[model samples]
Target: MKKKHVLRLLAAAVTMGMLAGTASCGNANQKTAQENPLAEEADSAQTEQEHESAEEVDMVFRGGTVITMLSEDDTDNTAVAVKDGEIVYVGDEEGIETYISDATEVIELDGQTLMPGFIDGHIHEPGNMMTEKKELILPEGQADLDVYKKELQSFIDANPDLPIYKASGMDLQAFPDNIADNEWMDELDTDKPVVIADVSSHGNLANKIALEMAGVTKESTPPDGGKIFFDEEGELTGYLSDAVSLLSTLPIIEYTEEDFSSAMKEFQELANSYGLTAIDSGGTIYETEDPNQYEVLSNMHSAGDLTLRINTTSWAGQPLEGKESDRLIKLLDDSQKYTSDFLQICQVKFSLDGVPEGATSALLEPYTKEAGQEEGYAGTQKATEEDLTAFVTAMNAAGYSVETHAMGDASVQRSMNAFEAASEANGGTPDGVINKIAHVNLLTTEDMTRMADEGVIAAMQPLWFYYDPFFSAQEESNLGKERFEQEYHIRDMIDEGIIITGSNDYPVTADFAPLHAIEAGATQQSPYEGEDDDPAYIRNPEQSATVYEMLQMYTVNAAYGAHMDDIVGTVEEGKKADFVILGDNPLTCDVKAISDITVEYTISDGRIVYQK
Candidate 1:
C-alpha cells in the first residue's frame, strides 16, 4: 500500500481522541433533529422512555478506550450500554450514564482498550476439536519419533477397556523415516488396531490390523481423492492419504452425538478464552454426506450450549463420489432449519487444490522437487475447470455464497475464474452474497486484479505470512526468487482494494489469538521476536500492514467476510453486544508487545463470557 494512505489512516485514528457517539447502524455520523425533522417527535418520546426505564438495562461498561471501528470516526474514552442482547448506546461516559441505573451491572475498565470481539475468519472447529476430544492428540513438534510410539502404546494400554485406538497430530516431517512403513506401530500393537494421523490431518499411519479393519489390502483400490501406499514388494504399508485416510478411520473411530457436543463445548471455551465471538467453520460436514457435526451444533444451539456465532460452508466433491451439486444444495437448504443469530449456514466450500507441501496444490508453474512428478511437474488440479465453474454457478444461482481453498497460484486463478463465471451467470453478486477464496498463499498480478474487480473476499491467515523455518527453504526452492518475494503479498491485495480478512486455521496453528496474528502481520516476523531475529526470517517486510489495518482485518473486515458486518463487526448501537477488553492499546503499544497484551475481559451477548 501507499505510505501516504497509511499515514492518513493513522492520522485519522489519532484525530478520534475523546469524541462521542456516531450514528447507529449504517451512517457514520449521528444525525440531529435538524437533519431529520420528521422523526424528531418519535425520537424525543423514545429518549424519554429510555431514561424512565434506564434501571432495566442489562449491562454498562465505562472508563475504557473504546475502538468502535466506525470507519475513521471512532473514538476513545467511550462507554457502551447493553439491553437484552443488543447494544443500546456507544458514546461518551456522560452520555452512556443517562441509560445506566442502579440495576445495571457496571464494569469499570480503568483505561483498558475495548474493541469488537475477534473473529477467526477461517477455522475448522467441528472435525478438528471433535477428533482432539475423542482421540489422543500428540504434540505438534516432536524431535524423537519413539516418543509418539511410546505415547500411543501407553494410551492404548490405559484404555484397555476401549474397543479401538485412534490418535492425531503426529509430525510426519519430523519422523518420515520411522513412518516409512507400519512396522514400528505393528511392533507396539498388532492385536488392537491403531491409527495415528499426521498433523496435516490429510494422511494417517496405521498398523496392519487397522488396515485390515478398514478393509484395505494390497489389491484395494483407493477411492477418488485418496491414496493407498505400498512397499516395493506390493505389500500394504498402512499409509493412507487424503479422502482414504478419512474413510479408513471411520471403521475404527466413533463420533457419538455426545462426543460431538462435548467437542463443540471444548472448542467454544477455547474460542471464548481468545475473545472470539464468532468463527467461520471454513468447511462443514465430516468428509462428505455426513452432517453429524451440523446436527450436533444445531442441538447445542437449541440447548443454549452454543456461545460463539458459527458460519459454515457445505463441503463439495470429496466423499460424495460424483454426487456433488444437488446434495450440496440440499445440505445448504436443510441448514436453514438451524439458522439463528448465533449459527448460520452461508457458503458452499470447494477445494480447487491442496497444500504446497503435499505437491497437490495446483500451480501455474512446476515445483522444484514435487513428489511423484516429472522435472517440470506443476501440481494437480483436484477438479476440472468446467465442473468447478458449474458448481460455483449453481451455488450462486441458489443464492448461497461460495468459498474455495486455493493455496497455489493455479488454484487461486481457477477459483477466481469460477467466481467470475458465477457472477456473470447470476448477473453479478446478488444482495447479501459475498464470495471468498481461502488461503490465497500465492497470487499473481492478474489474479489480484480479478479478485478486486470481482469483490472476492480474501480470507487470509496473517500468521502464515512469515517464513516457517521447517518449510521456507523448500517453498523458496519451489517458487524461485521472483515468485518467492511475492508469496503472501498481503499489502498488494490491500492496495488493490481486496477486502482481506484475518483467521487462524486453529489446528494448523495451535493458537487462535487475533492479537498474535495482528502483531505478526505488522512486523511480518515471528511473534516471538528474540527467538528468530534473523533478517532472513522476514517473508515480505514491505507487505506488512500497520497495527490499525490489522485490527480492521480482525474486526470489521472479518465480520464483513462472515456476512455479520451489519450485526457484530463494529461497536454500534443496535448491534450485538460482542466486544473484548485488552490490557493495553494495540494501536499504540510497542509492536512486539501486541501479542503480550492480554484479553482482560470478553463480553458476548451483553454478558461476560471470559475475564482474566
Candidate 2:
C-alpha cells in the first residue's frame, strides 16, 4: 500500500478502535444484588464500611507499571487495588492505601513491567505436549545428526525403559547429503526404534526399527496429500510427510490426567506470567464417544476451573456423527446458546494446507525441486471446489462464522470462492459478522482486494515472517521482483479497510509472545536488532504502525475477530474487566522497547487470577 494511504487508513482504524472495547461472572445459584449488600453496591461508601470491619483486602500490587492495554489515557501506575478476587481500581499508590487495611497482601514488584496478558491466537497445546512427550529432540542451532545421535545415546543410557525414542524438529535445508543424507536413519540403532519429527511438523524421518513399529515398509504406498521419501536406488530415505500420517502411526507416551493437568497448570502459569489473561484457544466444540482437547476444556468450564476465557472453533466440514453439514448446524445451534463466559464456541476452524517449509503450503507456484506434483504445482489443495462450496453453503445456512487456514494464494482463492458462495447463500451483505482467513501468508494484492470487498477478516500471524527461512529464499529465487513485493503485504491489507489482527500460531514458531507479536506487527521487523544485520537476505519489513494500532490488534479488533465486540477486548463500562497491569506505559517507552514489557497483574472477568 502507499505511505499516504497507510497513514490515512490507520487514522480511520484508530478512530474505529476508540469506539470498540473485556471481564465477570456470578456464581451459579448465588443470590442477586437485591439480597446481598456487597453485590448490591460497589461504591466508595461500601469501601469505607469494608475498611471498618475488614482486616484488609486479599491482594495489593504495589508500585509497578500497570499497562491496561486500553486507551492512551489509562494509567501505568504505582499500584492496583484488588478485593475478593477482582481489581477494584487502578491508580496511584497513596490513593489505594484505604483498601490496604490489615488483611491486604501487598506485593512489591521492583520495576517489572506488567501489561495485559498475552493472547496466542493459534496454538496447539496438545502439539506442544508432543515436544516433552515422546521425548522429541530438536536440532541444536546449526547442528546435525551427530547432535541427535549424541543426545539419543545419552537418553538411552539414562532411561532404557522408555519404549520408543521418537524425536522431532529437524531442518532439511541445513543438512547436506555429505553430512546427513535423507537416509541417515540407517546409522541409528535399529533394535531400539527411533523416529525424528521435522520442525515444520509436516514431515518425519524414522529408523528401520521405528518404521517396522509403525507398520510401514519400503513398498508401502503413500496416502493422498502425504509422501514417503525414497533414495535414487528406490530405498526408504526415512522421510514421511503430513502430520496426520505420522501422528496416526507414531508410537505414543501416554500421560495420566494428573500429568496432563500438571502440564496445563504450568502452561497456564506461563501465560499469566507473560500477561495473558484470556485466550481464544482456537479449537471448537462438538462432542461424541471420541472427544479431543476441546472436550477437556469444556469439562474445565463445567468444573469452574477454566481460569482463562477461551473461545474455541468448531471443526467445519470435518465429519461429526453424520455429515459436515450436520456438524455446522449443531455448532450454530449451540454456538451462542452455551452458558459460562469461561469457555465459548462461536468460530469454525478449517485447515486448508501445510507449512511453507515442506513446500506444501498451497502456493501459487511449486518450489524449485519439490518431490511430487506437476513440475510447478506448489502444494496439495485440501478440498475440491464442490466440497468447499457445499461446506460454506451449509455454514451460511446455519448462520455460522468460519475461520479457514489460508496460507498460499491458491488456498486463499478457494477460501474467497467459498466466502462468495456463502455470501450468495445469505442473499445479502452480513455486517458485524467477521469471517476470518487465519494465517494468510503470501497473499497477493488480489487477495486483499477480495477480502475488503467481501468483508473477510484477515486474521494474520506476523511471527511467520520470523520463523520460516522462506523470506530470504523467496526474495532471491521464487517470487521474482514484482510478486515478492506483495508478500505479507499487511500495510496494504489495512489500507484497504480489511480488519487485521495478530496471532502467535504457537507450537509452530514458539512465538507465543503477544507483545513481541505486536512489536513485529508495528515495526514489521524482527524483535532482535541483529535480525536484520545480514546483507544478502534481509527479512522484508512492512510499514511501521503507531502504538495505537498495535494495541487494537489484541484489543478492540481481537474482540471483533472473536465476534465478542460487545463483551470484551477493551475496558469500557459494561465490558468485562479483562486488562493487565504493566511495569511501564507502552506509550511512554521507546517503541523499540515495547516488547520488553512485563506483567505484574492479570485480570480476567474482573478476577485477579495472577499477580506478581
Candidate 3:
C-alpha cells in the first residue's frame, strides 16, 4: 500500500547481485588459457582442428529441463548452443554437442529449469530511475495524515534551503476527505512551497505557497488534459491532476543528466536480477522543452552501459497541446538515429483517459452517485473522438504503433474503433507495429472480441488483479457493482484468443516478478500471502488462467508484443542467447510455489550476467 513496500521488494532484488558476476565468469574463462603455456601450442592446434570440424560456438548449456516455449517438439532436456550472442542450436544433447568446441564455455545446469528471460511489457523509466534519490520522500507504508506531516516536516528540516519541497507516495485515501487538503498542508509548512503527490502520480496536492509559486490563481486556467481544484469559496484546494501535476512537481526537483544515467543503470541492474533481458518503457515524458530520455538511453547503449533491451514510446504530451502531428512525425523520424540491438524507439503513447479510482476514467455509463460525484458524470476524455481517430490514423499510416491509456469501457471502445478504422483505411493491419491498449481494467464483451480479432495487444498488469476487501469495497462507488464484479477478466481474454502480455507498471506496484503475475493470473488471487486471503475478497474466480497460458503471456507473448520475437522470445536456433535458470520448473511446480522459485542464473548475449 506504501512506497516502502516497493523499496523493500527492491532491497531483496539487490541481494541477487550475489549471483555469480559476469566479471568472474570472464576471468575464469581467461584463466583456463593462461594456466598452461607448454601445452598451449599443441592445445591451440588441436582446438583449431576441433573448431574446423565442429561448428564452433561460444557457450553450451546442458543438463536441465529446458522449456523452449516454442512448441512441444522443442521442449525438455534441450541443450542450447550460442555463438557470438546468437543461439546456434537448441535440441537434444546429442545434436547440440556437435557445435561445442574445446574453447566453448560449458555450463552445467544441474536440475534447474531454463526458460526465456522475462520481458516486462510496460513500465516507467523515470520513477524507477529516481526512487533512491533523496529528492523524493517516501513513507514506509499506509500512513495517515499525521505520519505524512511528520515525514514532510522531517524532509523540510533536512533540506531547509530547498526553494521547492516536492514529495510523492502519499496515500490519498488516508486524508480526512480522501484528498490532501491544502489547509492541512499549509498548517504543516506555510513558508516553504510544498507539493505532495498522490500515490497514483497522476495528481498532487499543493500548498498555498506552492500554488502561488506556480503562478496559479483562482482565475488561472489549467493546461489541457489536466484539472485544478477549488473549494466553494473559489479558493485553490491545492489539488492538480495530469498536466498541472507534472508542471508543478518536475521543475521543483533538480535532476541532472548524470542522475538520469545513473538511475537507468540501477533500473537495468535490478531488472537483470529478476532475469529480465528486456523491458518496454511504456512511456516517458519530461518537463523540459525537449525530452532527453531518448538521448540518455542511446548514450548508455553506445557506451556499453545498457545490459538489457529497452523499447520506448515517446509521450504525446498534454492533450490540450492540440494535434502534434508534425512534432510526432519529427520525433519518429529522429528515432532512426538510435535504432540498435539494445535500444529502439517503437511507438507513440497518449493517455486517453484517467483512472477509475478518481472517477476520471471515460466510462460509458455513469458511476454510482454514492461516491459524491454528479448524477450524469461519465468522466472526462483528454481528446475528442475526431482528434483521437486522426492521431491513430496518422501514426498507423506512418508505420508506427500507438499505445493508448484506456481504462474504461467507453475509452476502450473508442480506441478499438480508431484502430479498426485506421487498419481498414490503410488497406490492412499496420505492419511493423503492434497496437496496444494499457490497463483495460474494464471492457465490454463485444469490444474484447473486437480487440482479439483486430490483434490489438493487451498490456496488462496482472499484479493489480488482486481481489481484496480494501480495494473491492470501493468498487460500487467508483463503478457500479455489476461492472466492478467483472473487472480484469484474464481468463476471458485468453478464451477470446487475445494476445496478452504481463507487465508491472513499476513504481506503482511494489513487485514486478513474472512468477507472481503468472500465479495471480491463474488464480485471480492476491500474491501477498501474508495479507488478507478472505474468500469474500476474490474478484472473479471464474476468470482464472492456466499456468502455461500465463507463462506464455510473460515470455513469448511478451516478446511478440514488443516486436522482439524474432530475436529473443524462445530458446531456439538463431535467437539471442537469453535464458533464465530457475530453481524449479514453473510449469511443473505447484502453482502456489511458482512465486517462491528463485532465479539461479540469467544469461544474456551468450554470457552469464547473473548466477545464484
Candidate 4:
C-alpha cells in the first residue's frame, strides 16, 4: 500500500501572531508566497529553469476519503495538495507523490474523512462570547416559578457585585399564562436591575429597577415592532417582546477593540472546533451599540488573523421607509469601506417578524386558541409589505442581497413577495447577490416553489428541525398540531430545488455543531443523547434529508449562499485549502451516530487551526 503523506514546507519560517492577548485564529504555519522571501525566490528561480522533479507543495494529504463536495458522483479523488493557501492538486494516491519533496510536511490522515470545512450560513459572531461573559444561563425546561426563583437567586447571590443581574435561557412557557412579571424578579433583587431573557432571546422579563431605569410606565406605548405586556388592570407586567426587549437597561459592558478582537479569536477557535472555516455573521456585526465590532474584524483581516471567512451584514432597522431606507442604503454604502477578501459587508438584514413561540410571527391564519389570543389574531407583521418590497428592491438594485428573519408562513410569503418585487424591479437578483430568509420554520408549499423561482436561499436551522422537550411543546401549542407538523419542510424544499443552507443560529441554538445539525437534518429528530426511537420524537420525518444533502447544506450550498462559492466549499484545485478531517465518515456511519463522529482536524488556508 502507498504510504499516506501530506506535504508541508519545512524551510519557511512560520510565524504566528498573537492579537489582543489571545493567539490569533490564523494558521500557525500560514505563509503566502508573497509574504515569504524564500517562497518568492523559489518561484523566481523555478521560472528560470525546468524542474527535475515535481514542484514541492506546502502541504499534502493522501490517506483519507476526500469528499470534494464538487460533485456527488465524483469520488475517485483521495489526495489533495496545498501550496500558498490554495489547493494545488487533487487526485489519487499515486498522483500525489509527484508533488512530494524533502521539505514537505506530510500529514497522514489515517483513514479519516476529509471534506470542505463547514460554513454556517447564518450565525451571530461574538454572541457566544457575550452569552458566556454577560448572561447567567438558567436551567432549561424548568417551568416552575420556584425553580426559576431559586436559579435567579443563586445567580444573583454568586455575582453580588454586578451592577445589574442578567440571566438567559428562561422558558417563556414556564411562566404563568406564558408571561412573567416584575414581582418575582423584584422579590429576588429590588435594588439592582434584574433582566432575564427567554430561551428564544425574543423576550425579556425585567424587574422594577430595570424598568424604571429604562423609563417604562404603564401608560407608555410599545415601540413599533415591539410588545409591552400589561396585566388585567393595565399594570405593567415587565415582560417586553421583540423590539421592546431592547428597552431593558442591561448594563452594556464597555468592550474595547482589543476585547472584541480577543472575543473574535475565541469565537473562531470554537467555530473551527466544530469544523467551520467560513460563516455569515447573521447581522450581529452592526447590531450592537459598540462601534468597534467592524473595526476589530477589519483589523484582524489586515493582520492576517482571521482564520474564518466571514460574510457580515448590517442591520437594516424596522419600518424601512423613505428617510430610513435612504439611511440604510447609506449604511450599506459606508460598510463597503470595511470589505476585504475575508470580511465582506454586501448584505443587509431585516427582522420582518418574530418567532411563533412568542406568538409574534405574522401568519395569514389565526393562531390556535392555546396561544392565549383573541379570535383573528394572526400575529404581528412587524414590517409593512409595502416597506419590505420597496427596501428589498432598493437593496437588490444597489447590488446587495437582503436577509430577512421570517419564521411564520405569512412572513415567508411576504419575504418571497419582496424578493419577487426586487427581481422585477432590478431585472433580477444581481450577480453575486443571493437574497436569504433565515429560520424558515414555517414555509408554504406554494412559496417554496416561489422561493426556487425567485432564487431565494433558505437559511435554515437544522437544530430546530427536531422535537426537543422545551421548545417543541411551545411551538406545538402556539402553531397547533397541523401547522407545527408542517414546519421545516427540508426534504420538500430540496425536492423543489430551493437552495437550502444550514445554520445553528449560535448562542440562540444550544448546539452549534454542524455534524449534530447534519444528523438532525437527515433524521428530522433530536440528535441528543438518550433520545429514544419513539415515533413522537421525530418531527416531519418524511421531510428528512439524506446525509449527503445535509453535508451540501453546510458546505457548497452555504458557500454559495454567502457568495464565497467561487473560492471555497470544494477541494478542487485552485480553491482555498480549507478542510475538515473527521474520524468517521458521516455518510457511512449509522444515521443516528453522525453527530458522535469526531472532528479530528480542521485546516484553513493551508494551515492546521484545530486538532483533536
lDDT of each: 0.70, 0.57, 0.69, 0.74
User: Residue-pair clashes per candidate, as listed?
Assistant: 0, 29, 1, 8
lDDT: worst 10-residue window of model 1: 2-11
Relative to the unseen true structure, what is the C-alpha lDDT of residue 27 in candidate 4, on a scale of 0 to 100? 12
Residue 493 C-alpha lDDT in model 3: 78
User: In candidate 4, what residue range of length 10 has the lowest lDDT sum?
Assistant: 5-14
Ranked by lDDT, the better of candidates 3 and 4 is 4
Candidate order (TM-score): 4, 3, 1, 2
Q: Cα miss at 198, model 1 (Å)?
A: 2.1
* Candidate number that wins on TM-score, 1 or 4: 4
Which sections of candidate 3 miss by over 4 Å? 1-53, 72-74, 215-236, 243-250, 285-291, 320-323, 532-537
Model 1 spans > 4 angstroms off: 1-56, 126-128, 161-164, 176-183, 208-250, 284-292, 319-322, 370-372, 477-482, 529-536
What does candidate 2's lDDT look like per residue over 1-612, in tens digits?
000000000111233533332111111122211234554467977755754564455666666766555566666576666555445655666656776867677777566544444454555553454346547556434346677777766766666777777665565544653112345555655367776666555567777777777777777866544566666666766677653454356555665554555555566666766667566544521122113344566666676565566656666533212377675566445444343556555456777765554455677766544233347757776666677777766665555567777666778888888888778877743443457777776677777788878867767665544322332442224434454445566666777777666566555555466776666666655565555333432344555556666677666566556555455564432345566777666767877687777665776665666776
**lDDT tens digits, residue span 434-469, model 1:** 788888888789998998788787888877777765
lDDT of 4 by residue, 296-377 (tens): 7888888888999988777776557866567766776766677666877677788888777777788879999887667888
Compared with the true structure, model 4 gives a TM-score of 0.88
The lDDT leader among the candidates is 4
RMSD of 3: 8.9
Number of clashing residue pairs, candidate 2: 29
All-Cα superposition RMSD per candidate: 6.5, 7.2, 8.9, 9.4
* C-alpha lDDT of candidate 2 relative to the true structure: 0.57
